[model samples]
Target: MKLNLKQADTEIQPQWQPIVGYPCPPEFEPSTWVKLWQQPNPYSHDEALLLCQLTEDEWVAWIPDQGETVLYRYQFFQR
Candidate 1:
């Protein structure tokens, strides 16, 4: 995926905030970090929205800050 700052403007704030560097987990691949975005919920203290890339070979899954044990997997093709 590519980062289109111009296109992102319509969806997100125009400000660019640097993310603190953190070591990627050994289990995660470099592509896993591509074109990802996250936002915290203003109404809920522990809620967040995570957007990520999905591939045919692999699917994207997430466990919310407060949610059931089930893993919510999403396919990129669906989008």
Candidate 2:
């Protein structure tokens, strides 16, 4: 969950904007974003395989036969 300081400076700051489409509420805080990034996956399968195409700030969570969900960190830079 490393953050790209350069990218962050370019994409965030000024208004502290996040990459669009992440599940961030209007009032969400930066600390909350960091917590989400640090959360461990409860799934047993290969997490890396599930995240192959995703950037560091991007993530995919498997929900078994229920399908998968693609997630991104709002206000976080891609590692």
Model 1, runs deviating above 4 Å: 1-36, 43-59, 66-79
For all candidates, the clash counts are 0, 0
Single out the weakest 10-residue window by summed lDDT for candidate 1: 70-79
Best by lDDT: 2
Computed on alpha carbons, the lDDT of every model, listed in order, comes to: 0.33, 0.41
Clashes of 2: 0
Question: What is the per-residue lDDT of model 2 for residues 1-79, given as tens digits with 9 covering 90 to 100?
Answer: 9876664445543767677888764432222212234323554222222332266456564434334555565522322
Error of 2 at 63 (Å): 2.4
Cand. 1 TM to true fold = 0.17
For candidate 1, write residues 8-57 as lDDT tens digits: 44565589655679654343332232221322333422322233424534
